[model samples]
Target chain A: MTDKTPHDWLNEHGDYLYRFALARLRDTHLAEDAVQETLLAAIKSPSFEGKSAPRTWLTGILKHKIIDIIRKQGVEQPAEDMSQYAAEEDPADEFFNERGHWADRPLAWPAAENALEQKQFLSVLQRCIERLPPKLARLFLLREVHEEDNESICKELQISPTNAWVMLYRARMGLRQCLELHWLGK
Target chain B: MLSCKQASELLSQSLDRPLTRRERWALRLHLWICAACRRFGRQLMLIRLAVGKVVAETEQNENLRLSPEARLRMTRALESGQ
Candidate 1:
């Protein structure tokens, strides 16, 4: 490959690699570092076999770089307790009576098919997710974004299966409520 | 009888883990009569689908790019073998 190949990689794959790292690491600085390390490693390697797509190969390297960071970080801080999120306190109460019937039924949302196509919907969704408490947000993403299984999520966050379940429930409830108030209002 | 609260928790838990036969039966029975819980269940599914789409869009969007400083630093490191 020519000298321009590295520059080409930088131009083409930089943002993609950065986002992959960010999603795994969730720290902008660490994500940037991992991207740099992956590109540097790719450049230093003896040959490019072109066996897999270049982006895939780069991502594979980036994944390892992220794993190293996770390992070095060792035990993550315990996920925030579910009680800290206000939504957990009485989420059911708002919608259900003491007898557990619907006291205040959820409003009918606009057709989700139409809503998904709106570009603003995602921004609203993202902001709602950001509003979640830090640990809840992480757990939500671990399941939804990373598609990690429950066991891995518990192991990574140092929480029990029960805690994981409660937190996830809270996160989902919180997001749905936030969307209703902020985004889905007609 | 499973109230809406209990039934809703069952629905959310079903997404994370399988429901027990008893829990499934209870939730089913409650949902049968409660139009509100039924609507909530459908909304939950929509939230799951929409979240998946937003995450895909997030991965592809240009908004998450590295800063110029980081990009330049990475480029220089690659070029110089440092």
Candidate 2:
């Protein structure tokens, strides 16, 4: 394969890299900075022997860049208020009755098959993710989107293992309900 | 019998880690008897699958892109670094 110039790299991989960062950072400026830094680092590194696809190599660099930003931001930002999560009134209460049975039975989603191939379905999913409470969205994205392990997520968020589990459960519950309402038409 | 609330939490937790044998049995039993909880579990699994697809497609998604200004700024930065 022939060598591509910096301009070529920017034209090809810029948006993909930017979106990858934006999903994790949730800040447009931070995502832009990350993509810029990743590209710059890729340009400077001597290790690109052209063995792997350029996008894959660049994504490898971008992943580390994202981790660094998450670590740095973790220190700079104050701990998120988790008291609401610890309250006695569980969010799950909305779905369960006094007997702990489903207050509203979940309807089977017949449309779920091949839904991923539909752009509209994906956009609805994205909207549901955006609608999530900020803390829940972050935790969900870290675990599901970035594929971070539970231990590392708890450490990064300064939450205990139990809290992490509870938070993740809440996130999934929220997303499931959102999809059911909007996409499943329930 | 595990309540639907408890069983649902276990279903979500099972995504992240291995469940204890007792927890697994309780969940299985609940799922066996509870159609609603079974539907919930299936939907949760579908959501996970959908999320994986969404992440993969975000790269090629036309709606999500770097602004032209950001792209130009990145280009200038790259050029100066050379």
Candidate 3:
């Protein structure tokens, strides 16, 4: 099999690469730059041995670029003030009663597997993720999207392990409510 | 008996870390009696599965893309680098 030229790579995989980066970086310029950088590196390296699909190979490179940028941002940006997060009201209070029982008990989501296959459901999920508080969203993405472990995430966000767990719990709780309200309940 | 709030929090934390024997037993006991908490646990798992699916299939999503100008700029950069 012959190798495709750089233009061919761009034409075929450009948007996919851009979307992947944007999901992680959430900054348009950074996402675009990451896609470009990945393509350039792919062009320079002779590492494509045709074991995986072109898109998969490109994504591998893009993942590293994203991680590097996140690391840099961790250093450049001030540490997150986690005290404010700690002081924030428990999200569970909205769903639980004074007795700590579920006020609005969770209903079983019918056909949840089918919802995953639908494009509309996916978009709703994306919007819910975007609605998450910025720090919570970052922690969620680092764990769910980037597949980073809790230790590294704590280090990257300058949050303690306990705080990371609390933040992640908040993020999941928020996302669950948003999904139920917007998609499942409808 | 674990309250619904504590049980649910333990359920969420189980996704990130292993629960101790006592915590696991308490959660199990609560889930056995609490239908709502059981549903909550399943829904949390579904949310995680949905997020993974979104990441896996992002390439097929037409709503998200690089703008034309950015694409053009990247193309130029690639050409120059070549």
Candidate 4:
């Protein structure tokens, strides 16, 4: 690795690391702190011989930093009233009729296996996630992205098993509606 | 007869935890007859896949750069570590 100064690392990889951190951490200040920690770690490590892309190396460090924070913090109590997101109650009723049948069937999506590779689709998905209420969004990510099980999520969030299930279900339902509108509708 | 709502909840739950025999049977029956619920289940899986991809690709993305102020703060922190 070239003897690049800290400024060089910042200029080259700071923002990318920040976005990566922010996407998972979901807190602006914490994201900044994680990026700061990543940069500091990079400086200490002597073996970053440019074997991989600079951004890739920095991201690897940032992933660890984010995990460290999540571990140290344990379960973060939702910073706000989670009930507001939950208070609306599940709109499960709308999907069914009096006899508990599909009042409105879910619209069919094109069988595009490559949709996941499309940048636009991801961008739309990102927007949909961002639009979710914070606690719900975090729970969704923890479950789907982090692969945390229901018990751990319930334990960490200090919610009951039922609450955890409801929140996750709502998040999926919400994401489905959002994608139907933004990505598929496009 | 599980409502689409019930089936949807069960479907989402199955991703997190193992479904019971009753749930599995109920969901299978519901999906077999309800095309809309079936579509929802498929779309839910697609969304999960897409999110995983987005999260993975974000790590290596270069299009987004840090702001000047933040870059400076992060840089100083690293230099101070040295």
What does the lDDT come to for candidate 1? 0.74
Clashes of each: 0, 0, 0, 1
lDDT of 4 by residue, A64-177 (tens): 687676655544343223554445533665556766676656777767587776778889999999999865676677677775567875665566776667767778988888
Q: Clashing pairs in model 2?
A: none
Pick by TM-score: which candidate is best? Answer: 2
> Local error of candidate 1 at A66, Å?
5.9
Q: For each model, chain A TM-score?
A: 0.66, 0.73, 0.68, 0.61
After superposing candidate 2, which stretches have Cα over 4 Å from the reference? A1-8, A23-27, A43-46, A49-51, A70-82, A117-120, A152-159, B79-82
The global Cα lDDT (0 to 1) of model 4 is: 0.75
lDDT of 3: 0.79
Candidate 4 backbone collisions, by pair:
A15-B66
How far in Å is the alpha carbon of A38 misplaced in model 2?
A: 1.7
True contacts reproduced, candidate 1 = 0.67
Model 1 C-alpha lDDT per residue in residues A1-186, reported as the tens digit of each score:
344476778798889999877764667898898888888888777665553578888887876676566545542333444444445556556756888776767778777788788777777887888788754565676577555577765665556777667767778877888888888673
- Ordered by DockQ, highest first, the candidates read 2, 3, 4, 1
DockQ pick, better of 2 and 4: 2
The regions of model 1 sitting more than 4 angstroms off are: A1-11, A21-27, A33-51, A60-97, A101-103, B75-82
